[model samples]
Target: MNDIDAWVWWLVGAAALGIPLVVTAMPEFGMFAVGAVAAAIAASVGGGAVVQVLTFVIVSVALIAVVRPIAARHRTQRPQLATGVDALKGRQAVVLERVDGSGGRIKLAGEVWSARSLDTGHAYEVGQEVDVVEIEGATAIVM
Candidate 1:
């Protein structure tokens, strides 16, 4: 172990940290891996153990403090795009069968879908147009 270079150890640490980043898909581990690389550079330049450890700690802490919040902000940002079943909401669907409180059918987005009236007392006749309010399982609630 005495013959092993300090830089080699640093490189090994970086590789070890990188494995978790890849396996878990966590950005924090990647930040630590980057810090290990910085430490490896310090070791290669003949930095003392104190300097190498300080370099790693400073780099890792700085990355955590700076990058984490930015990453979190981006991660929490919701896309405005609506797709799939969400697109069905508020859409106009044509009643294919008499739609009542119990059950009925409607042609939604050119697809046949089971539907129910939002108002139990309101029944729609065939060929009537209704607005989709929500989707529960395979059924679309219409108003």
Candidate 2:
């Protein structure tokens, strides 16, 4: 009980820091845990208490400074992958029936969908290619 080394204590501290990282899903704890491991390495190499403490502080602060901004940027960035109805917008469709402000049909994204013109008094003839301006609940508004 009296013979526990300083390096062993540092490793235990690292494990303690890791517990919160896993439970809270916060990355800062992981950075601190890495720092504690660095301190443990210093202690294993016969460094004094001051050297071990400095190793922990420097490593932890460096990791936080380098990684935090990158993580924040990724969190704030919008995903680029368009999906579902959003993907259908700005796509080309073939008019299967005469399309006007009233209504018609078009083959959009390999499926036949009810459609209408985006502009009134403008019409698309059958077999004409039109752009899908927007989708409105089972209907494609075309232009």
Candidate 3:
């Protein structure tokens, strides 16, 4: 084969191999999709017709087999759970007590939560409009 044809075949083989490696390593859509498309183009242009089709099918199956377990493992490790004051952001609440520079109390979502001011050294009155900035333990930092 000519140099150009040799280069094309090399690219095809590299992509067929590299795509699966990339999918195994990162498994993200952007990487996998690009790799798959590159491999398919290379195979179609530079490989025998039957080998190109077989390579595409085999590489795709292998990528899916390898990536599926990794995705499943990631999901299993961090199974979604709901808890804590994270569930309280954006909800309206009343300042139950004056917040000193240190801390105060607020009634939010029918629950009383310890609160601190993001604007440090500023005191909030017992009845002030506040937004929940974040939740720390049982305390909600307010703005």
Candidate 4:
């Protein structure tokens, strides 16, 4: 086919690759799409078919090699901030009522939470301090 037609086809391929990048949230597809755009530019400037193909491959591979690892590192380096009840674990609380093995109440994170002692034989009096061990349903296990 003519160079103009070939460049058009390359641009079409680039657009096709972009669809999957958007749908799947994959960065590799975006890299390939950019490579396809580069190849399209090469074809427009009178590059031979072999040169166009090589340009596409080199650009795609280089981007994948360089960008993918940086992206992965960024993904993994994000600080994992605990939320919800998971954040309550390991926090200090004050007993609002006598807490025994069965149940009681505690002031945790400014909220009153149903609490039980982590140790079956131990008990906490009102105004005692405790550490939350875990959250079980609507209750907190403390010690």
C-alpha lDDT of all candidate models, in order: 0.96, 0.97, 0.69, 0.96
Q: Estimated TM-score per prediction? A: 0.77, 0.77, 0.47, 0.78
Number of the predicted model whose TM-score against the real structure is largest: 4
Q: Of 2 and 4, which scores higher on lDDT?
A: 2
lDDT of each residue in 1-143, candidate 1, tens digit only = 99999999999999999999999999999999999999999999999999999999999999999999999998899768889899889999999999999999999999999999999999999999999999999999999
Clashes of 4: 0
For model 2, the superposed segments whose C-alpha errors exceed 4 Å read 76-86, 100-103, 116-123
Q: Mark the 10 consecutive residues where model 3 has the least summed lDDT.
A: 26-35
By lDDT, the better pick of 1 and 3 is 1
Give me the overall lDDT of model 1: 0.96
Prediction-by-prediction clash tally? 0, 0, 0, 0
Q: Pick the candidate with the highest lDDT.
A: 2
TM-score, candidate 4, is: 0.78
Global Cα lDDT for candidate 4? 0.96
Candidate 3: tens digits of C-alpha lDDT, residues 1-143: 46454336536555665666666764543334544565557565666656655655666677667877887789778436646555677667789998655999988888887898878977788988788888877788887
What is the model-wide C-alpha lDDT for candidate 2? 0.97
